[model samples]
Target chain A: MIDQLIEAIIQKKSPIVVGLDPRFNQIPQAIKEKCLAEYGETLEAVAAAIKIFNRGIIDAVADEVPAVKPQVAFYEQYGLPGMAAYLDACQYAASKGLVVIADVKRGDIGSTSKAYAKAHLGQVQVGNKNYQGFPADFATINPYLGDDCMKEFEAEIVQEDKGIFILVKTSNPTSGQLQDLVMADGKHLYEKTAEIVAGWNDKICGKFGYSPVGAVVGATYPEELSALRAQMPKAMLLVPGYGAQGGGAKDVINAFDTKGLGAIVNNSRGIIFAYEKIGGDYQEAARKAVIAMKQDINDTLSSVGKQYW
Target chain B: MIDQLIEAIIQKKSPIVVGLDPRFNQIPQAIKEKCLAEYGETLEAVAAAIKIFNRGIIDAVADEVPAVKPQVAFYEQYGLPGMAAYLDACQYAASKGLVVIADVKRGDIGSTSKAYAKAHLGQVQVGNKNYQGFPADFATINPYLGDDCMKEFEAEIVQEDKGIFILVKTSNPTSGQLQDLVMADGKHLYEKTAEIVAGWNDKICGKFGYSPVGAVVGATYPEELSALRAQMPKAMLLVPGYGAQGGGAKDVINAFDTKGLGAIVNNSRGIIFAYEKIGGDYQEAARKAVIAMKQDINDTLSSVGKQYW
Candidate 1:
């Protein structure tokens, strides 16, 4: 999975991954009204609007970005219809030849974690038949339960040749409330979390010298990102908090390796809602937004003599 | 919500929550074969088996226990069909006059958390009307993202008068790998997390002198459970790790107040799969299991002069 992601980044000359985190209101007025007319303002209408809106986003950015991350929370609010829409978005993104990352942030006790691993990354057995449940190229995981619980996801990654990004430092305002607490060993909790990621990453490596077992460090904290970058040297970073979350290209510059290939920056609202802020077709605007974002990030890397291209 | 939960505990003379975390193989052969005959070898058959098995368990324990917690991971592995079964189980428990606790340890950034809160505990707006997503009485939440991210769930609790349990010390073997780390303040990380919980719980209490805001302190760690109970005085303790997790009734004594009314102990496999160990009808065995579990818990509490009844 790491090799494939790296290959995509090199081919596109952009280490950018678009986030398909859509809100109902964020969907174009035209699309929303059409769906409402068709489904009579039901949850089905909401799902339809999201699917259509996501289709536009994927078509626009599929050629520009290496991956598309769909935050499950956004679609989950509408109930069963919402889940259907979430699955459709994932399938559509895959059909476009884009790496689909399910930003699920799931983890649990070992036995339960095995079920979640099967839900997102592997196959589940039903009598003599086996079926995949919401399969994706990568999924996000929560690490609060520690290494023993993560064994299931680790096993799934090995069995399916897939990937996962475990949370280290999040981008929320109070993220440091717990993450920055100094431990008895004089290391912050997030730093300790990064050390754990580095250890796990060492057990698995791809052709590009990166691990499929990656880490998520928010782009909101540049210094912490830089520090974690050095701490988990082989980890591929899924750096969220870009754009709408107040993380500029310069703010996330340190997330990259010397060759500008170790990180994928996610921008959701800024690119998907570009049409609302800039008057034009939503798809065309999203396409332009992706191009502008890629250029901004590449420019920052080049200024530091780290641009691969 | 806390008052209602307290009233139910008083009426039932039990502070027990039956965990409906079923594994497919654990289902009685009769139920499994019936579902397989009905739906063939498909995810539908798996969902059918879960719904039927859960109904039997709920029917057996509804009069004995005040609440039932349905862990989502077990159902999620079957995809859309599994999710449908999960909702059915929640609704069935509610229909049986039992409080439904959706044991989904979900958390994320504020926006994402809002969607999750709506999905499980509150109403989501669609166009002109509001629709429910899953609508459990309470939901378990993961607290790795900190307080700012929790504001959404907090708001949902306030608006809908629902409840949530935040993970403090989990039941897994390696939960201590991160939770038991000594902080610079000379306290464990879980202790600091308990302090945070205590602070939040103080704000939103109910008529029963308890808060709808709760904390999950595993029964597996008796010492930590006792300490956390003292730390978060007003917060209800959702104690997991009972029964099949190697925790006896005596092991969970510390999770309660002197009245033995401030905590709910959860037992999954031990009660749900009792027919496999003890003969007779599955429903009858489940009823006897719940009765024995309640007696074991009450007797332990009485020995310590903490029995509420």
Candidate 2:
């Protein structure tokens, strides 16, 4: 899956992954009304609307991007039907030949962690059958619980060829409160996390010199992004906060290697909700938004002597 | 809800929360066969089997414990039907007057955090209607993203009187990797987290003096538990690592206050899977296990001159 994600980036000439994080209020009124007409002011209605909204965005951008990350929290807000819609979006994106990243941010210890690994990455077994719960090629995870806690996720990566991006430095303003704590060894907490990720990255590299294990260092912090990029050269980075969260193309330039193969920048609302700013058919607007983002990133990378082609 | 939990502890003379973390392999054969017969060898069968298994344990232990902490990982392995069963267990435990702590350990930042806060602790508004996704009195959350990321969860506690337990000092062997890191400010990471939890605890305390905001300290680390107890006096502690995690009654003794009202100890496999060792009806074994656990904890607390009644 890591190799496939890298392959897609080179083929598309775009190190971009659209984030399918739908806020019900931001959903188009026409789509919402149609769902409400069918399901009538219930969770099902909200989920149906999100399903359509996600399909529209995925269809528009699948031809231009390497991956699409569907955040579980947005779908989980509506309960079972919402999760059903989330799965539908993942499946639809995969059907379009795009790598699906389930941004669940799940982590725990021991067998409990293994259960989550099976939920998003591995397989579940019943009496005589096995089932894949959420079909994600990769999933995002929290790293507070430590390396031992992530052994199950590591096993899934090795056995099933799946991948995971562990959070290092988040995009939020106050993320520094904990992540920036200077350790007694004179290293920041995120640097320590980056070291841990780098160690793991060394264990599993694809033919292209990238590892299935990756780190998520938000593009909002360009200096940290560059520092972390240097710290974990072989680690593929999943950089959030690329657009709506106030991170510009120039800010994210540090995320990529000179080969433009080390990172995938994600923009959620900035791309999916582009119709609000551009004023057109949502699908066409979303398509145009993807092209614009691809051009913006590629042009910036080119200025730095970085190219995927 | 904090007061209610305190009251329940006093009434039952037990500050014990039975961990309803069901493992499919540990479920008795009879229940599995019945579900298999009804739903065949599908995820449906897995979910139905877990539903019955969970209900049996909930019925047995509800009378003896103040709460039941159902870890989400186990239920999530089966996807939607599994989640349906998880909700069923929460509803059933609540129906039996037990506080349902959804041990989800979910954390994200900003509106993403708000979506998760809504999923477990708050309600979602859809047009003129509102719906609660999962009926949990409290949900456990990770704290790696820092305090500001939890603002949405804080809002839910004030708005709906819900509760949350944030991980501080976990019981895992390698939890020290990140949690025990010595900061340049001369405080361990967990102490910093405890201070943060303490501040949140002060804002929304109930009449009994404990706050809806709590900390999860592992029973295996008794010394740290006692230290953190003094640091966050108003915050109730959810102590795991008891029994199956190798923490015994003696190891968890420091988790309580002089009034024996500051903490709740959890034991999952020790109680739910007791039938395998005790050799009896699963329900009866679980019931006996809960009573024995209650007695063990009360006896230890009484030895230190602590009393709830």
Candidate 3:
């Protein structure tokens, strides 16, 4: 799956996966007016507007990027109608030949964890019919419950050909309070987590020398990124905290393996609603921003003597 | 709020807060058939059935118990419509004058945590109108994200007369793998967390000598419960893993203070759907189970020379 993801990015020559976290109030007035006119104030209508807005973005970037990540909370805020819209958006993006990563940081213990795994990544039997869970190639999981809690999710990754990005180090500013705390062993908590991540991936290394089990290492901490990358050479890195979160392409360069086959950079707000910041037409601004990001990443990789698509 | 919770429980003289976790498949065949006949196969209908079932239990036991804890996951399994049913059930339970402790187990970083806190216990503005969140007297929270993640929730407790139970020692078998791991300070992880819980409750101590900040200590760990109680003398305890999880009322006695006024026992399957296990009429089985549990808890408390009720 990582190979397929990498291949798709290389073919498109863009690693951008537009994040659709359409905070209703943050959306541009023009889009909001149109959405309200079309759907009205009902939650369903609002959700439909969000889907339409996302579909427009997907339509414009289908051939330009590898995937789209829909943060589940943004949709969940609106309730069921929002969930239906999110599912629709995911299906639409997949149909456009783009991978969909469900950004739901779910973590639990044992059978409950299995239920969550089934609810999100695997099939769940409801009555006589077997309903497919969210159609995402991968998901982000919380690892605070410890490694034992991840066993069920790991089993799903093996049996079902799915992927997971365990939270090794998050992009949030206060994340370091707990994640960076020095353990008795002298290693930081995140370093300890990364070590376990590497160990967990050891049994699941793929043909491309990467593992289906991945780590979410923030792009905000470039120095830590390099150290973590060196420690977990086989784990794919999902680098958030890019663009809007103040991380540049150069900062995330060391996160990838030499072959540029082990990392995926994520820029949510910067790519999806670029018009809000860059001040141009929505599609044009998004296109330009994505192209610029691709170029910047390519330049960073080349400068580091690493392969770049 | 802890005073209210303790007083209500003591006044009623029952420790059990029937947990509403209606797994669609696990529901008895008779109830399922009746629900299917009444509501059809639609997710909304099934969720409505769950709401009705919970309402029935609340109505039957409202006078006998102090509270009802509704596990959010079971409702969330159906998505938005399910959440609506959850809201309906909570409102109905509250209407019956039963304290509703939403068993959400939610935790996130900063603003997101605040949003969840508001969505479950406080308030959030939807538009020109402000909409009430879950309106529960209390909700369960996961504290894995560290103390800062709880600031907003703690603020809500102060501002809104609400409460939160932090996950300290869980009931699941694998909980010990991470929670019981020895930390650098010679104390176990949960012990450290329990100490934090005590600190969080210091300023919020109620008239009844308990605080709004509570600890979720599973009934399965009696020794830990006794020790944790000693550590957090003023923090209320929500003891799960009772009845069906192989914990008797005796196992949870140590969680309470000497007055038997500091803990609320939770039994999901043992109370709500007792007919499935006891094999008789639904209401009859539920009523009998409630009576037996009440008696058992009173007996245990009496044996310990503690004043219950």
Please write out the lDDT profile of model 1 over residues B1-309, one tens digit for every residue. 778888999999999999998888889899999999999989999999999999999998899999999999898889899999989998888888899999989989988999999999998888679998887999888888998757888877888889999999999998998899998879998998888889888898998778988999999999999999999989999999999899999899989898777999999988988898898888999898999999999999999999887
Residue B112, candidate 1: Cα error in Å is: 0.8
Docking class of 1: high
Q: Model 3: how far is A114 from its true place, Å? A: 2.4
TM-scores of the candidates, chain A only: 0.98, 0.98, 0.95
Clashing residue pairs found in predicted model 3? none
Give the per-residue lDDT of model 2 (tens digit) for A148-260: 65788987899999999999999988889889999999999999889889889878899889999999999899999999999999999999998889999999999888877
Off by over 4 Å in 3: A1-3, A34-45, B1-3, B35-45, B132-135, B203-205
Considering summed lDDT, which 10 consecutive residues are worst modelled in model 3 chain B? B124-133
lDDT of each: 0.90, 0.90, 0.78
DockQ of each: 0.84, 0.82, 0.35
| Best of the two (1, 3) by DockQ | 1
Q: In order of the candidates, what TM-score does chain B achieve?
A: 0.98, 0.98, 0.96
Per-candidate TM equals 0.99, 0.99, 0.90
- The Cα RMSD in angstroms, rounded to one decimal, for candidate 1 relative to the true structure is 1.0
Q: What class would a CAPRI assessor give candidate 2's docking?
A: high
Q: Write the per-residue lDDT of candidate 2 for residues B1-309, one digit (tens) a residue.
A: 888988998888889999888888889999988988998988888888888998889888777888999999998888888888888988889999999899999988787999999999888999999998887999998988887667889878888888999999998887888899999988999998898899898777898889999999999999999999999999999999998899998998888887878999999999999999898999999999889888888888888888677
Ordered list by DockQ, greatest first = 1, 2, 3
Clash pairs (backbone) in predicted model 1 = none
Off by over 4 Å in 2: none
